[model samples]
Target: MKRLIATGLALAALAVPARAEEIKELNFGFISTESSANLAKSFEPLIKDMEKAIGIPVKPFFVGDYAGVIEGMRFKKVDIAWYGNKSAMEAVDRAGGEVFVKTAKPDGSSGYYSLIVTHVDRNDINDLKDVLDCAKGYNFGNGDPNSTSGFLVPSYYVFALNNVDPTKCYKRVVASNHEGNLLAVANKQIDFATNNTENVSRLQATRPAEAAKIKEVWRSPLIAGDPIVWRKDLPSDLKAKIYTFFMTYGRNGTPEEIAHAREVLAKTSDGWGPFLASSDAQLIPVRQLELFKAKVKAENDDKLSADEKAAKVKEINAKLADLDDQQKKLPSM
Candidate 1:
């Protein structure tokens, strides 16, 4: 009888699944586009506000680059993150993350362009071609490898398409964050660098003196807005709170309330309007860019015969077409 009772108790315990630990605090990670300390300071107000709204401690994790944040997510060290389109795609694939919201421009646009920039005072570097030629005699700055505007757009539209590698074409080539690259150009520390309209607008609004020093030499087609991604497996209640806080943060509030939310959001996104509901499908443009880049590489592969290259390019194009169809079916904001 004693053995039977013990066995029954054990069976009951086994039948009742262990409860999952509730997330008490969130580690929010973002790439350091500026000094990490400065970035942290900039986000502190917003973090505190988020903590208050969600009733949990919100910790900021500012990493050196986009990869650092992605890896942090992969290891489950980061609970949520801000990501560019490519990095957001990476997080979804590697870190079990999904986009829940995106930053909106003050003008309500959901996208901005990558730009090549030069010193405003330089007559010799008046155009994209001139900026490319400047590389022969001066240092050049690119954005970090994970930067969409800083690296990918320029690589595809400016360098690879033109059959020129900046490393080989320039006296020296270096990579840094967009803020760093822009500052280098503004300070005349680098003869040329890549920036984006969003960052440029931010600089203009916050640091007009620095903004005055640079001019856009060329621009790429609009890229998707930055995304706020969170672990897909986060508790449903917590997720709901996060979504509600973001979607309601700056809109349809009392004047003071709306102003406060806008101020906090501006500090975070360099003058973004507000947060809008978003989803994983927002990353389709990035995937399409990846596909286009692959197609370009396959078409230009020297080892492949003309027929082989043509076939490879055709395959990539077909994939891109399929991607477009998928994108077309996704809900738009």
Candidate 2:
């Protein structure tokens, strides 16, 4: 069975390659995050430029959510792609993907904040605990389950504070990407949700009418933003193509490249620009988030032996506690 699965994946990886010399099809996976079809349309020029630089035909595969897209990467269905930091870490851990690019603020920082939010009219909800307590019977929405802030830190930390199980404590829960989750809360379809301040600020700046309906009541500690990543097993030459393509594609970009880049970042008000060099360290927080989730899952599994649970639980708790301290140690600024 494992061998059959392996062969199936080997075939999927070839869905797209930069060159027929080493690959045929190049499938780039994305989700409803910033690069969803809504923006990918404007990016046709950009993708076309990328294809020219890399010398291959590239097709992007849109999956509705991050986990699905990341899973596709693991199964070799998606080739090159973007990932929220948490999902990126999981891909690298399980499927050997590596972070090759990241968005940069003018200051060269990769940080973005998570805002725990509720409808502006919902005054009774003052904070995360307030929502979890007063709205237990209400469905709470989550962005990508693998999102660093959207679902990871917010789910673990908020539930830890409220002493509740997100899976069982809430009357209902729905998963979507940043835009969908925010819209759900804004439209009063769910109790609350967490989104990056960067995204919210973008919407507010570009589409205030829609942003006006949402209010942030709680904010998370700093976290790294989403990243561009590719499977490490890809040929070294392919990595060079991807790396060089992004790094230099717009070096002396024609007005068209600059305009297209701006179009892709259209929603961000902070003026987030394109890729900059990023290291694996930028992903440690996300990996820690994955560990936190694994711990929670292990605690709830009934089939595991007590000894097994004990061992996993100990490791999980230690990492989470350490991460909490690590977060607190960062300067608030």
Candidate 3:
């Protein structure tokens, strides 16, 4: 519903955390990006940290790709993961993964934007509207379609505004990493692409040599950020430990650990610092985004033939209306 992409056989909570359980092993999942190194190193300290904080034998399962990791969660494979907002929503909805925390940088902000970028000197294309106009002549570059800022929300952004099919209208479309896609456009290989605001800015701030060759023409309004999640069935003691660990720990003392944490998380790129605790209410934006998307889809479905549109609209409007009402009914507090 929020951040997850696949379906699951629904399950509910096992129990609340009364006391930390004996952790024999802990499996974790993350996207395969250079930014994961921090969690790879500093995150292990958490196993040790938890073992000391509580009394248990702990391990960390570092898996690649958020989708597979989330899938594993349904069966209790991953103890924790950093899922983008959309992925998080789906995990909580399907597998009973609860949103435990959100990330932030050393700075105070909570989220980042998406950028529509082209090659460094492509003066001809400056905004999303322009990209749609050039869809017939230029190739579009995308990352893994499941990527958060990289693909999921950004793809929805494009689909929201236009009717063109990415596969057919563009000269070609290349799904590559944000860095790779940016490099492709800079090298004049691809015409346009999307990346994170934090990522684009970081490139300019930390690696100006490479950043100069890139130009951003279109950017998205801020969407809610990613979340750290756990299965609802996880024992409360373990859930509390997981949540507390993220909320309290900082890359302190261990400069090596801190540096590794920085590398793994790449907060500069994501516009979040280290992980911090968040409540379910923080996820309201994601649900709102779903509603926005449903609205757009409903509008587009209206363009179909009268009979087909009528049937689809009736079904679509029912679901969208339900979601919208859910948002409104949320407690005012």
Clashes of each: 0, 4, 27
Worst 10 residues of 1 by lDDT: 4-13
Which tens-of-lDDT digit does each residue in 76-131 have in candidate 3? 88767667777777677776788767777665467777778887788888777788
Task: For each candidate in turn, give its C-alpha RMSD to the true structure in angstroms.
Answer: 9.0, 8.2, 6.5
Error of 1 at 274 (Å): 1.9
Runs of candidate 1 with Cα error greater than 4 angstroms are 1-19, 252-254
User: How well is each residue in 56-87 modelled by candidate 1, as lDDT tens digits?
Assistant: 99999988888999999999999999888888
lDDT accuracy of residue 75 in candidate 1 = 92
For model 2, which pairs clash? 15-25, 16-25, 16-26, 17-25
**Structural similarity to truth (TM-score) of each candidate:** 0.88, 0.76, 0.76
Candidate 3 segments whose C-alpha is farther than 4 A from its true place: 1-21, 33-64, 201-207, 250-276, 280-284, 287-305, 331-333
Report the Cα lDDT for residue 252, model 1. 48
Evaluated at residue 242, the lDDT of candidate 1 is 75
Per-residue lDDT for 1-333 in model 2, tens only? 334334334543553354445676678877556546554664556677778888989897886677777788888887787677878887888866777677666444667888887789987788766867744486878777677778778877777544577777778878777777778888899878778887787667656887999998988887775687887667656666677666654343789976765554543333566567564556767767677667777887789999999999998888888877876776542
Per lDDT, the best of the predicted structures is: 1
Query: lDDT per model, in order?
Result: 0.81, 0.71, 0.64
